[model samples]
Target: MFTLSDMWTFFLAFFLTLPLVTLVHEAGHVLAARAFGAKIKFTLGAGKTLFKIGPLEVKRLYFMDGWCQYESLKYDKLWVHIFIYISGSLSNLAVILVINFLIYQGTLPVHIFFYQFVYFSVYFIFFSLFPFKTGEGQPSDGLAIYEVIKYGKKADPID
Candidate 1:
């Protein structure tokens, strides 16, 4: 039975939950980069600029995609780069754990929003950790980590 209200809830679930999850994932990268003393730019979506605040940008298509870029880390260690690479998925995992704990403890009531949040977080984690480089030559976090560890490959300099 699909009611109009149920349809709206479903739409809101995806539209709201996904972007928040994405922000969490990118924030993880930014946090790790900052820890090693690197400058960061976090861009959400593509197309015309909607707003810019500090290192964060929200574009016209806010729900389409997002990425975080950073300058060289002060540490410049293999482990530091690996940590930064994996931090995004790790951040999503942390949020899932916290939400589940809250629900289990009765601190937060069960709701469709929370469920969708958890679901999308898990979805984000899987794809982000699947090692592969894009045709556009952008290496995924997992691919970057693997390449760094396996080949001692250094990341390209920020242009």
Candidate 2:
């Protein structure tokens, strides 16, 4: 069944959920990269650049796609790269944890939309961690980390 209200929900879900998820996830990458002394330049979304202020670039209002790209990343160390890649999903996991706490303490009211938001957030977290090989047979962050630990740099799927 389709209705105007359902359409609204869909829109709200995209608008509200995208920003929160993108911010937390991308911030994780940016922060970790900064810690590792990597130059940070990342897109909030792809398309035309809406504006740029210092290290941050705000792209098109499309808002569906975002990725972090570091300049002069240290490729010599496996562990540091692993930390940067894993931080995004870890931040999403942190959000799930905090939300659970808020629900437990009765700070945030439980509602359908909130549950949907949580589900969406969790979905993104797990999807990033899932390690399913892409069409190009590339391993995910979790799987890539495993390969690095067990097999060494030669096993990295991206390279």
Question: Which one is best on lDDT?
Answer: 1
Q: Tell me the whole-model lDDT of each prediction, alpha carbons only.
A: 0.88, 0.73
Candidate 1 residues 20-120, lDDT tens each? 99999999998999999988888888789999999899998887788888876888899988998889999999999999999999999999889989999
CA-only RMSD, every prediction:
1.6, 3.8
Give every collision pair in model 2. none
Worst 10 residues of 1 by lDDT: 150-159
lDDT of 2 by residue, 104-148 (tens): 899998876667667877877787777676555666667767776
Q: TM-score of each candidate?
A: 0.92, 0.77
Worst 10-residue stretch by lDDT in candidate 2? 150-159
Give candidate 2 regions above 4 Å deviation. Answer: 73-76, 132-159
